[model samples]
Target: IYTGVYADGVNQANRRKSRHEQSFVAPEWGWAWPMNRRILYNRASADPEGRPWSERKAYVWWDADAQQWTGEDVPDFEKTKPPSYRAPAGADGVEAIEGIDPFIMQGDGKGALYAPQGLVDGPMPTHYEPVESPFRNQLYGQQANPTRVEYRRDDNPMNPAPPEEHVDVFPFVFTTSRLTEHHTAGGMSRYLEHLAELQPEMFVEVSPALAAERGLEHMGWCHVVTARSVVEGRVLVTERLRPLKVEGRTVHQVWMPYHWGSGGLVKGDSANDLFGITLDPNVLIQESKVGTCDVQPGRRPTGAAMRQYVEEYTSRAGVTDAEYPPIVTVSDDIVTASEDTGTQEEEDDE
Candidate 1:
């Protein structure tokens, strides 16, 4: 389906003409041009009296002598409406819009922290575990988010958590992010040698503590395990990641650059491959930023055999693909106990 909504006509002049016209279009088809300008409802910058918020930010104001509206910037008005006009209560259509409100596109007249209408799941942002998770929710009684998605396929198996255990065998939480030099998934980087050399291959970074625990050396391969999948990458051990004491337990984290999709010169499985398409309730952004996995020092098994390798870890964890990190506890004492124990031990041994 398509809707013919072109915000820009032939030129800037024509674009301005169309701006004064009311238009609606479907999501599938629309165009903004001459810079793809998209301004929020600019009219609300003015008070009901038609004066702008400030001279620097001034856009429009009422002209009492001329009995019309005037503005140095884009005049967001009917071109002649006076400032004294009052809207009746419960008025329908444009009149119902409060004079100070700008986001008329939304149902309500405010910049809502909780959007009651647009989003499907809910309005506020809630932290949920990704499909592949290593840690349960430390902030909530529920371990992984109850709403996280799980795929039953061979490519996507979910790891499970034991009872009351927020941390799992895949002890380190892993997240994939982009490198500034490489675009997302690394399509452009593949064609360019300079970018490829800078980040030649798929690598996962771990803290020195995790590297030592796993017997992984810098630039050596480390097998990252989750119930559904396994991928091996070169290791970069650094001090940047220290164990975080969450809920009285020391939690480790790992980092991976997700720019190595299959099409690149440095080809690898999509970091997104490990991610199931669960979305944030407010903005519908995929919950791909954080997840759980175990790390081991070794080359990962290849081809069909890799699946078997991951399955072995899942079996040892004694949980099914549907389960994840156990429920979170709300006690500050429980959360901080791990750190406290370490400190007390240090003091007592002294």
Candidate 2:
């Protein structure tokens, strides 16, 4: 494993573990599979036909004097082979690869702009409205990933899908992400007292409009609810979160940081726990980054009362996958049209 190997919580067997799947290796080196190497697709630096793209970032280049292929990075081709040599279509090894095949990791060695295989869902990335989405799906008919995982345990209850039509009682969407000041999940940052003091308590940042609507004063206690969980934090009313205008509908967003899990020194309720196990199919990454939730003023119930609050929220906002979220559209046609015109003008000058 290279750098950035993180202990991403427990496994299915409840064992504490870590993963570093990004490492790659060179052929003839000591290591093998079951352990990924550092340079799995080093061949991609070259163009399709085994020609180097640029002399500077070149992994391999032809040496006219030596009449052989040479490179600074590991050579994706046979060491002594010349660029002019061609292997037949059915031939194995490097010869069978077309000049356009850049990513050598796959058997075919081609760069797939649109992946035909390997991904669980369709290969290309498509935006889906979150399971607890406030807006309509904009990408054709596809809503969220149909295969989104739902953990049936009592600890994780999901919201009902549309058509069944759940109530939008706590009518706001919230996203929990990392702040630059803290590391991913806050396990490391909570260990330090100075860092803990700076962000002393778990806080939920809300827009001033939402705060006023809910009768929440600045720095007051606020309760955020989702289908799965209810988390309480100090309110931080800010203007940074304005209502976004999308497709003639107003969409408001709340930003929360998911740093305070259990076992940390300055720990509080985990923001990640509020999200059900909905994930993006292509990368198998949790869609904990975005979800739907409702916020209200005042402190959350403690002990048994807290559990009731979560159950009540789940009963109201039944879970289901729905449409894709709206996106801002930008046209690249003008840029493409200018490219051909600029090339013709340059050629005329010559």
Candidate 3:
């Protein structure tokens, strides 16, 4: 599919002339997939009769004189196909698709408001709280995504969520993201002295208000504690990490870069250590982006003390064993088996 679409010896001129706003599509510069068509389903930019929807926003349209589709970008439909062409009776495959249908790949050649297939959850979009969120789901009685996968193990203990007691043990929201200076987990970039010097050590970003509330000093050592593990980092008190008011309650968030590890040239505790194993049911992607953690002002304990420290918090939160949070919560009541069983109770018609 990428035959003539890549920048190479023969296609050097097109790649060199690539510029922004150059004829909008810049078909001559660079390349795109599926026969170098810059836009997908560009036929939608025109009307059923193949006239441009608007002159200012014209993209791909039919050339009436030549009786073929032509414009700034290549037409997504068959090149010689005409606007008035209709699929004959008993037609199948490409021949079955109407000329006016921009989304030819779909069964009915139309965009779906609610997907009928290709999803593990329901067909329609629905909101669910994060697996380890501090607050309850305000919009729905169902607290979190019931379809989410959980690993109920002694090592991967979950933090207490809404309707669970001792949620305050790990009150603050903790999140991890990539830093521009280093590549993912700093495997290659940390080995390079230049890149390592750019972001030498791992640091957590917090708002000034949170620092004051937690007795944390700017640029001082601080540790984030989760039921899973404890990770320490230098503190960076900045206004960029603001506290949000969710449900009229102040919610402080701690942000960290997950590019540091023990093997790297610039070593530090991994920010990912603070997350438990909760996954999206469809793709099975680990939900490590956000969770709950408690922030402390000093470096975390070492060796056996570290294990004891985590145990103390978990014991208080009532999740020290293999028992995980309930999968389904309706009106702050468990309506499903514990996360280990992954079983949900059928709803009762009230």
User: For model 2, what is the C-alpha lDDT against the true structure?
Assistant: 0.65
Instruction: Give the candidate number with the greatest TM-score.
Output: 3
Model 2, runs deviating above 4 Å: 1-100, 123-125, 262-264, 318-350
User: lDDT (CA) for every model shown?
Assistant: 0.64, 0.65, 0.85
Candidate 2 minimal-lDDT segment of 10 residues: 322-331
Using alpha carbons, what is the TM-score of model 3? 0.79
Q: Per-residue lDDT for 292-333 in model 3, tens only? A: 999999999999999999999888889868588888678423
Output the lDDT of residue 272, model 3. 84
> Considering only N, C-alpha and C atoms within 3 Å, which residue pairs clash in candidate 1?
133-292, 134-292, 143-327, 157-228, 247-335, 248-335, 248-338
Error of 1 at 255 (Å): 1.0
What does candidate 1's lDDT look like per residue over 204-263, in tens digits? 889888888889999988878765577778999888878888667788888888888667
Please provide TM-scores, in order, for all candidate models, with all chains considered together: 0.63, 0.64, 0.79
Instruction: Indicate the worst ten consecutive residues by lDDT in candidate 1.
Output: 23-32
For every candidate structure, what is the RMSD over all alpha carbons to the true structure, in angstroms?
11.7, 12.9, 5.6
